[model samples]
Target: MNDDEKTRDYNKAVAAFAKRYLPYKQPLLKTIENFSPELADVVIRHGLYEIWEEMTPLLSYRDKEIATLAALITDNTVMKEITAHTENCLIQGMSKKEVLEILTVLTLYIGVPKIINVMDAVKQAFENYDQHIKNKG
Candidate 1:
């Protein structure tokens, strides 16, 4: 495929990735796409596909997400990432309870106050996942 065709393929992958993992952020992503089309490509490529290809042998995506969630909860990242990461954790192969357990484990180190906020994000992630399932049905 030519560069244009490769870009098109990557764009399709981005759309599907957003639809499946970011079900609630389509509008936000659309706005970003409207503003910076190149960003979505670079982010998707680096954030997910590249990581999976290069790092999965060292850490499975689900494990990476567990660590990602811990970092996000610790304020190592934008707290807003929790919801999406939580869902991604699930999609990558965590059960809901396992995802919740992540938060549970973090509660000791991060404290209840911070954990409460993380819980809210996780709740939203679960809700979004449910909505996606319902819509699929």
Candidate 2:
């Protein structure tokens, strides 16, 4: 495809993926809309569609989710973002026990202090998952 065609395809795929996977909250979307159109475009087009889509083939969704969780735990990332990703991990087929184990292992590498917040996030995710299951049933 030509450059224009490729860009169009990427845009479409990105929008669809964001709607499904990385949907921004309305306030966040509005902020992006006003201040950083290019960043918003890259997140949708490149981060979700291009990067994540390309990586999905190489790693199982669960595996990628676990890896992402591990990295975020180690790096002491934004708690809310980490919690959201943990929820995504569960939604993508990771078990709560599995997530806990991954976080436990991360403690060895990143130290215990860094893992405290991750543990709390994982606990919240598990509670939410359980609530979701109960609601479904």
Q: Which candidate is the best by TM-score?
A: 2
Q: 18-40 in candidate 2: lDDT tens per residue?
A: 44343433255447546887777
Per-residue alpha-carbon lDDT of candidate 1 for residues 1-137, written as tens digits (9 for 90 to 100): 47786566566656556644756666755676677878865665444455544446687666777887889888934656888888888778789999877778888988888888677788888888788778989
Could you tell me how far off, in angstroms, the CA of residue 112 lies in candidate 2 after the best superposition?
A: 0.9
* Model 1: lDDT of residue 5: 64
TM-score of each: 0.71, 0.76
Clashing pairs in 1: none
**Best candidate, lDDT-wise?**
1
Candidate 1 deviant stretches above 4 angstroms: 1-22, 26-30, 76-79
lDDT of 2: 0.69
Q: Model 2: runs farther than 4 Å from truth?
A: 1-31
TM accuracy, model 2: 0.76
